[model samples]
Target: MTKLLFIEASPRKENSYSSQVANEFLESYKAANPEDEIERLPLFETELAPLGMEGANQKMENIMKLMTTGSGIEPEGEWAGVMKEIERLKSADKVLLSAPMWNYSIPYRLKHWIDLVVQVGASVMVNEKFEYIGQITDRPLQMILASGSPYENRFPLESDGTKTDFERAYLDHIFRFLGFTDIRLIRVMPTGMPGPQLDEIVANAKKEAKEAAKAF
Candidate 1:
C-alpha cells in the first residue's frame, strides 16, 4: 500500500476553497482505494514555533544522534514538538499539499513546517563528488492552491511582489530540491473577484479535484 500524506496549509477552515476541494478529492481517492495508507495533517491546527538559536543547536544535536544510531531522535528545545512532524514527511510515499495564497505568498505556518521538515540528510544530501544526492521521497508531489487575486497573469519582479506566483515556484522548487521530479499544481484563482467569476472558479476547482482523485 502507498502512504499518502495530505498537508493542509490553509488557515481558513470553512470558507477555504482549497480545503473544500482537497476534501472532495480525498474522499473520492479513499473510496477508490480503500486499502491505501492515508493521513491528513492540518498545519493551521498545529503550533509551528519559529527557529531560534537554541532550537537550531538542539536540532543539530538530534541530527548527530540520528547519524550515529541510525534511529530517530527528538531534541529538547523549541523544536521538540515539530520533530514528529518532520518524521511523518520522511515516511510518506506520496504528498499532497493544499494552501491558500496569502499576500502573494505561502502562510507562515506552512513555511515553518517546511523549515522543520526539509533537513540535510533526510530530504537532501551532498555527495562526496560535490554533486547533490536528493533524498526526497520517490513519489508524486501535488499542490492545491487558492488565490484571492490573479497573480498568475503578472510577471514576478523582485521589487514588487504583487506579480509573483509564490505557490508554484516556492513549493515546486522545494519538492524538486528533495528529488520529486513530478509535480501537479491545481489552482482556484481570483477568488476575491465578485459575481459569477467566483462560482466559475470554484466549479472548475471541483472538476479538477475530481479528475485528480483518479491519479492520486
Candidate 2:
C-alpha cells in the first residue's frame, strides 16, 4: 500500500478554492486505490518547531560532524522536531500539496514547514565537488494551486518588472531540489472573477483534478 502525504497549506478550509479542488483529487484517488494510506497534514493547525539560533547551530554541527567524522549525530531538543518532519517526507511514497496564492507567493506556514524539513544531511547533502545533492528521490508530487488573479499570461514576469506568480514556480523548484522527478500541477485561476465565471473555472479544475488523481 502506498503512503500518500497530503499537505494542506490553506487555512480557509472549505472556502479555499485550492482545498476544494484538492478534495476532489483525494476522493478520486481514494476510490481508485482503496487500500492506500493517506495522511493529511494541515500546516495551519500543525505545531511546527521553529528553527531558531539553537536549531541553526545544531544543523550546522550535524553537517560538520558528518563531513569530518563520516557520521552525523542524532538531533536533540527542538531540532528533533525538525528531523521528525524530514523523516515523514522521506517515508512518504507520494505527496500532494494544496496551496492558495498569497500576494503572488505561498503562505508563511507552508514556507516555515519547508524550511524545517529541507535540511542538510537530512533531505539534502553536498558532494565532495561542492555540488548540492538532494537526498530524497523518486517520489511523485502533485500540487493544486489557486490564484486570485490570472497570473499565467504574465508568468515569470509582471508589468512592473518584478517576478510574478511565485506560488507554483517556487514550489516546483523547491520540490525538484529535493529530487522529486514526477511532479504534476492542477491550477485554478482568476478566482477574483465574480459570478458564474469563477464557478465554471472551479468546476473545470475539479474535473481536471479527478482525472489526474485516477493515474496518480
Candidate 3:
C-alpha cells in the first residue's frame, strides 16, 4: 500500500494558513486514493532534541561503522527516540511538509527535527570520489508554506525584505541533498494582509493545493 507522511510544523493548527491549505490537498488526495495510508507528524507535539556534541559524535561513529567494519561502535548518549523517527522516515513512500515561515526560516522545533533526521550515512554520504550521495528514502516532497508578507522572490538577498522565497531555496537544497528531486511548493503570501487580500490569497492557495494533489 502507498503511504503518505505529512509533517506539520505550524504551532497553530486550524488557525494556520499552511495547515488549512495543506488539509485541502490532503482531503482531495484522500478522495482520490481512499485506500492509501496517510500518517501525520505534528512537530508541536513531538519533543525533538537539539543536536549536541554527543549526538554528533554518535552520528559520526555510526557513519564510520557503516563505511568500515573494523569494530563495533557504541553510541554515547540516549538517541533511541531520534533514531526511531528517522527509521519511520526511511520507510515512508511520500512526504508532505507544511510550515509557516517563522522569522524567514523554519521553526526551531522543525529545524531540530531535521537535524535529527538528516544523519550522515543515513540521509547522505560522501562517496569514494568525494561526491555526495543521498541514502535516505527518496520520494516526492510537497511543501506548503505561509508567510506574513508577500514573497520576495525577485530580490531574496535584499535588506529589509520578506524571506519566503529564500526559505524555499534552503529547504529545496536540503531535501535534494537527501535525493528528493520532485518538489512542489504551495505558498500563501501576505498572510496578515487585510480585507479581500487574505481571501484572494487563500483562494489561490486552494487552487495550488488542488493542482498539487493531482500531480502527486
Find the candidate with the highest lDDT and give its number. 2
lDDT of 3 by residue, 1-216 (tens): 999999999989998999999999999889888899999999999776656777777777787887797442453354555576777787778899999888787887788888877766666777889788877645889999888877744425656543435576778888888878888888898887768979899888988898788768
Full ranking by TM-score: 2, 3, 1
lDDT of 2 by residue, 63-179 (tens): 999899988878798789899999999889999999999987999999999999888787888899988788889889999999988766323754635537878878888897888
Please list all clashing residue pairs in model 3, or write none if there are none.
none
TM-score on alpha carbons, each prediction: 0.84, 0.95, 0.88
lDDT (Cα) of model 3: 0.80
Better of 1 and 3 by TM-score: 3
* Better candidate number, 1 or 3, judged by lDDT: 3
Pitting candidate 1 against candidate 2, the one with the higher lDDT is 2
Report RMSD (Å) for each prediction in the order shown.
3.2, 1.6, 2.5
Give the range of the ten consecutive residues with the poorest summed lDDT in model 2: 153-162
Off by over 4 Å in 2: 153-155, 158-163
Q: Please give the CA lDDT of all the candidate structures.
A: 0.78, 0.90, 0.80
Residues 1-216 of candidate 1: C-alpha lDDT, one tens digit per residue: 788999999877768999988887888788888888988888889766667887777667666776677654554566665566666887888888899887777898888888877766555665668666667656888788888776653346687544577666788888788788878878888888868979988888888888888877
